[model samples]
Target chain A: MSETTEKTYKRSHEPVFWGLFGAGGMLTAFLTPVMILITGILIPLGIINSQNFSYEKIHGFATTWYGAVIVLVLVALPLWHTLHRIFHALHDIGINRGRDWQQVICYGFAFAASIFVFTLLLQMF
Target chain B: MTKRKPYKRELPTDWWLKHAFYTKYMIREGSSVLITLYSLILAWGVLRLSQGEAAFNGWLEALQSPFSIFIHLLALALALYHTITWFSLAPKAVDLWLKGKRLEDKVIVAGHYGAFAVVTVFCLLIITL
Candidate 1:
């Protein structure tokens, strides 16, 4: 091939974020409402016994391997999905300045929060 | 730098507010804000959980406040909206071919709802029972 015909393609980092976004979106869509109902409404309103959500029981659950993973996923994955949408929604709403900074802040918040939860879980374990 | 200034059409900030379709689209996208807040609450709970039982219980106690309850209610509504929008868009992502025929959109959408119901009930059961 002649040098004039040779072309280079740069890889985009979009698919990684998109994969996390898709997985998080699926989890959020299927589980978030019921989760909010149980933890936020039922338990708080005393419709469900507070003992069910007592510190001991919740602490025990968080200490376990599977429970830690569940807690991390429940707490963090939706963040990836939501932040992704918020990033795009910023553009849609016409906050068009600093696209790079927007992407960094959006995805960076999710990354930082995920790490925060992961570290907490690890310490508990 | 080459002086090639392309014309850029400006987008009005309230473009989505002008049409019902765009409004609903914006609402669907807007659900993310509340959901993100909900996740941060959960994350904060985890941080408290790591602190100690007393700290964790304090977090739970704080959640019982009127403001917390109201926020949760709003989050729940937005979350359910997100679920509906996500399921409606499911058919596009799940393109299944069986016996040389594409699956109907309603079938795929219904399947998601069915699974969503099962998962919801299952979580409630595990938490309560």
Candidate 2:
């Protein structure tokens, strides 16, 4: 193994860790509230006019500045966190043999996801 | 039963809060209580929807009450923390391989957060419009 092995001590690992944190927090700040509000609207709409409760028919008062920016933040962060956790786990459990190989896969998926999100976000704008 | 001896032992102030291991565990396991509470709220929402408008409005008004608002805020914090820890750990569960190459955990976590963010923004935009 070209890599060193020691599981017990904690390396700062902050680059990936904070990356995940920033992504997750920003995403959560944007995303969850709108979903919850939808549930709020749905509950009343369903009870009153069950047949007319489809989201497509309703105007989106749900759209807001807070939600959009928050989501952008989340989009960037969680992926980093996800990648970081995977790297350590591969090492700890002895699954993947080489560090370089692991790095390749992690970055590969990260790139693909980034491309997909960037495209999707542009459409939204 | 053994004897209890008293020595003036000073404990670390940071204690569980300072430790990553404990912090992760807290965010993981400690979140269930808040989840359960939120679920009950949702369930009530559903039940009221079935019951009709007046009942639903009553529930909504109650949610706006000071006490309910306080509890909701607390639950939101716990749920958010739990979500963070859970997504952070998602990459490891995959043993994720692409084209015979393994993916890094950070990338995976970032991807998941991105999806979450995008959806949140989209939904918000739809609502505000």
Candidate 3:
């Protein structure tokens, strides 16, 4: 084969984002509802003892390595899934202008938020 | 380069609103917005947690607000909707086969629900107990 006949494939970044999206989707599907219920309703309403969510308790948990990882995943991963969907949903709603900018903002927001949480977790540790 | 203008069909902004199926699909997609908001709230909580006990407690206290409760209620409902939709679509993505036979869709979906239940309960137990 001649050198000019060689084909170069441009690798797409879709799989990385898609992998995060799928993992986030799975986490959200399995855990988000109860999380909302506990933090949002049950504990806040005092149906579940507010003491159970006391600051010391949560802070203690967050200081541990495993706890930090869990907290980071719980807080940040869903943004990957949701923001990906939001990006596509914008197109579905016919906001076709600035597709490049839209993709940047969508993925950028998820990236920024993930970093924000990750930084905080590191500091806590 | 030869100039080329490909004809493109115009899609109306309200295209999804015209049909019940499309509306539900859009709603499913829209769940992302609220879930994103929820995640941000948790992120804020983490930030507060790092600040100290007063800050973290304040964050938790804020959750008790009527408006916060309402938003969480809405988010919970939407998140549950997302879960249902995600589970239903799982079989298409999973493609599991056993003993030279493809697994049934309902079986895959049911397995998701079972796992969801276990996870939810496990979280609750961990937090409360």
lDDT of 2 by residue, B1-129 (tens): 869977897655445477798666645554444434544464444344434557656676566566665666666666566567668767766787899989988898998778877876776555445
What ranking emerges by TM-score with the best candidate at the front? 1, 3, 2
Tens digit per residue, CA lDDT, model 3, B20-89: 9999999999999999999999999999999998998899899999999999999999999999999999
- On TM-score, the candidate that comes out on top is 1
Q: Interface RMSD value for candidate 1, one decimal?
A: 0.7
- DockQ of each candidate, alpha-carbon based: 0.85, 0.05, 0.84
Each prediction's total of clashing residue pairs, residues at least 3 apart in sequence or on different chains, is: 0, 38, 0
Once fitted onto the true fold, the runs of candidate 3 whose alpha carbons sit more than 4 angstroms away are A1-11, B1-10
Every model's TM-score on chain B: 0.91, 0.76, 0.90
lDDT scores for all predictions?
A: 0.94, 0.52, 0.93
Docking class of 1: high
Number of backbone clashes in candidate 1 = 0
| Candidate 1: Cα lDDT at A78 | 94
Give, for candidate 2 chain A, the lowest lDDT window spanning 10 residues. Answer: A54-63
